[model samples]
Target: MATATFHQSIVSFASPSSTISQCGFKIDSSLSFTSKKINFCKIKAMASVSYNNTLLSPSKTIPDNTLKKPNEAALILIRHGESLWNEKNLFTGCVDVPLTEKGVEEAIEAGKRISNIPVDVIFTSSLIRAQMTAMLAMIQHRRKKVPIILHDESEQAKTWSQVFSDETKNQSIPVIPAWQLNERMYGELQGLNKQETAERYGKQQVHEWRRSYDIPPPKGESLEMCAERAVAYFQDNIEPKLAAGKNVMIAAHGNSLRSIIMYLDKLTCQEVISLELSTGIPLLYIFKEGKFMKRGSPVGPTEAGVYAYTKRLAQYRQKLEEDSEVICS
Candidate 1:
């Protein structure tokens, strides 16, 4: 196996003088993509990714500058792109519509905005639109790690799909599809046209059904009802993963995400009603010290604010860029 060792980190986030002692992570000094083994494998258990997208080992070295926040983890939330029903102005609810062509593009675009971010695990709703969005977005990630849908319905299914190779498993990201994260059930209004429904039910009544925090549409769920389940799932499933230092990404519906955002941002019922999220945009949050701090949406990878918000992200970006340059050199 071909290999190279660096006594010093040739790639630095800001300075050219970074040495091995200053960098806690293991990085092979020069690139030989054809190398049978890579430095990424050395820290695979801790970094949770391979060299396809990141230059660092799975156990990413934490820079001393951000040493105070060792438990910091990234949290990304993206609503699914426009679905076919969305294009038709229909009440999709939990109907399971696929994305429109425009929706596909939106997903790709959202992926670019957060392409630099490292995601350890992904969670998507049990609906196809959300699943599609998550899959498409990952295609744009710098790390070419595969996102595998974990099937645990039966022991046989789980055993049959196992990747026996340690390197292969470390390079894969687990995608968990959960019914609890599905969009709020619209009940009787699931397939109805939004405009027609409003006219049939009177504008005032329809407005209340759609926007009121506690009111339901016919037999459908209210925003409050959605929150009861969505937020509970967030706390029980997603939050603990972040608290454990795992970077996470969630792709779901507008209402489901809105409900979670309500909990994260501590939005009032009235305030959440006024909050708006465009389809396919990714919102970034930092989880540290048992609290979530909103970092807002990243416009693109070129946006300095997003990458520079933390030293780890900057180092991650710099390392990958250097890897690309070494290959081309």
Candidate 2:
């Protein structure tokens, strides 16, 4: 409910100035109390005093000039918005699914949320949904002149922009497609509906498949496996950005993001499984000296906005059900 209210207020800030001016608030309070009772007339009497104080204040604003823009040692992790598989409650695994119409809208809104932030580099998986979300976000930043730089295996660190300058006039923003960043491979569970999988494999087993760190689904990867690749890639590719003082954004899947979060937050495998990532929401991280310094809360339309969107989705689902019932009748 609080999130819903927040989302509603956030959505109203359509203008850049309004969005930047929005203030955050908090309340604090303290209390102390004591009591003494005497029984019978002969008993001695005691006195006690108590004091309480409370302070509530709006979040302090850091002047744009005074506030240090996040250093180049920053990373934004965003789960690609809902895909067709997500709508069907199917296991997407490593399968590439296109974003549904609503998913596209979510990505657009997410893009608008961080349009003003200076993002120097963008990272994405080979999957289309993640790639599309990254592209939409980049477009929102009005970086149309930046050309995508593709990294290939044979050349390893080949800078595609330099090579393709003659082919395309636009200055390319380097786009590095890496397999290490791909979503957890679901293996045999990839195409199965969640309910069906639960029924066939039993709920507990299915839950383990979905939530366990070391337990791979059939022939698929465990969270640990995903993290291994993700961390490796992060160190090899993403670490350089931070060292160079560049802000980076990574668009990927829930599992992949979880992998990175696990490393950054120092969460155990079990804990990582419990972490939730909302689609299209950005998780910003700041690093210093090859270590995490801080992480920014997801900045997006308020919970109210997400609730509104969810409600609309529910209504659409209900209408489809009703239509199907009518046809059956």
Candidate 3:
């Protein structure tokens, strides 16, 4: 394997940029020197000091232009990049397929698109393709936080991987893999080529099987049935985190993501049938006050110059950029 070298630097308060002046020498960033490398680096601010004693604490005052909002959370949903079955135009529902090399690149690009967003937790399906997408995208995160899978199946596993230090826990993102997030099981059509199936069964029949929300194909789970489990799992496992003001990133399959999107956007069955999500594109939503507000898709810096960031997202991005520039300078 080829190796790359990275340089990490800390930004002092005396830097030219005044935005990070109050942070002391807390800002951090890194740059790598290599041919085949992601040229991005994550900058993190050091922990702030707080006094516990009332007598010793300074007068509590809110910043004049602070953009931080309480009880507001971010949700980023991404369908896994193209799988081998996808390349072959096969019915890949519930099948364990790995990503193609192109898929790998797509995943990385997807990560870069949302790299500035903070991700507190990650969720993915048990299938390797979704799992791979999650891991690869995280590699490009601007936070530089390591993502560790939580294998709490057994007491031994949980105990062995447990973190002993609070600081270490703060620097890592927990990954949870669940089968409930898996793709709709295609049943008898699992390994069949989509074109061949359509030809054999007639396009109308195939269309009904593929696009009809309530119809299941030959012992398979319909999109409605799939949504029942997928949405429930999301509500039970993922919703509470957002409710608690934590940003979450879910790397899941096409149908599963579509189902979740349907719920978030309040899309009608007829409307959802026409919705098509491209491989590796991310959809963002701001969850606040028990409601989800769609932030649409983030257009990466290259393609659109500016992401259609909500007020909150724009502030968040600006804060990170100032901190990053300080550290890199």
Candidate 4:
């Protein structure tokens, strides 16, 4: 009878949900338990034990190709070769100006310098000065076969064309224009000569208007505003291409390019205001992991000719200031 009862208990335990109560057995101190029945209970208890254990482990890592090396991607920021307004020291604002004769030559030289490097993409402003410089540079670099993509708000019908006409060509170069990269709007100051403006307003006031970050000139955008717009566009559009190992170049105006550089270099408003970008010179930037690693200029620290000309202009301004001081005295 005892053996049979033990066997029944074992069978009950083997069934699903194998509850201890369902085994139809109870321990009593008054009654002496058989050794076999006791052994069966031990085995069943061992089988019913639940071990609650869990482990936390780190997730698999994704390789960051963008962070691998600075040489993986680059950005070349070139101010549009000199324009007619540039020579006259006039406020160009958003005005479309053609490049001067010397400006065209400068663009060709810039092309020669970067011809060896494989430029995967090019970006320029909608203005003619910038567009022409980009066109001239690409042609000189023997990459004119690449399609030029114009970014006019009105022109929405064009489809993406092949970078090169030759199907056999492996090289792919895309030239795109963006309005966000346009020159700073000079507002009421547009078309006025810098010297004449200084004479009309005080020299210190003109300097502050030109160099201050937050102070906008009569309905015009300030340097800080330019930086905000330019950086936003760069983060949304340009940064991804750069991360993907594309060598990008931007042909734009002085102020627009300056806005970009200020962001890339992490410069303060004051530092950005002090920066002076010469016409037609290419400023190269190396980026890694979405950060600026290094920057270089195709031309030396300063173009001697342009520097001398700027110094002469400064002297002319000083002379006017001295005359004003005497009158005030």
Per-residue CA lDDT of candidate 2, range 247-268, in tens?
Answer: 6789988887877766554444
Q: Which sections of candidate 4 miss by over 4 Å?
A: 1-71, 142-147, 151-156, 159-172, 299-329
- Cα lDDT, model 3, residue 27: 16
lDDT of prediction 3: 0.65
The TM-score of predicted model 1 comes to 0.73
Tens digits of per-residue lDDT for model 1 on 288-322? Answer: 66556666578886676664455543443344334
TM-scores, all candidates, are 0.73, 0.65, 0.72, 0.66
Off by over 4 Å in 2: 1-72, 142-171, 298-329
lDDT of 1 at 63: 27
Better of 2 and 3 by TM-score: 3
Instruction: Give the Å shift of residue 296 in candidate 4.
Output: 0.9
Task: Give the winner by TM-score.
Answer: 1
Candidate 2 structure lDDT: 0.58
lDDT of 3 by residue, 111-140 (tens): 998887778899998787888998999999
Looking at model 3, which ten-residue stretch has the lowest summed lDDT?
1-10
Candidate of highest lDDT: 1
In Å, residue 180's CA in model 1 sits off its true spot by 0.8
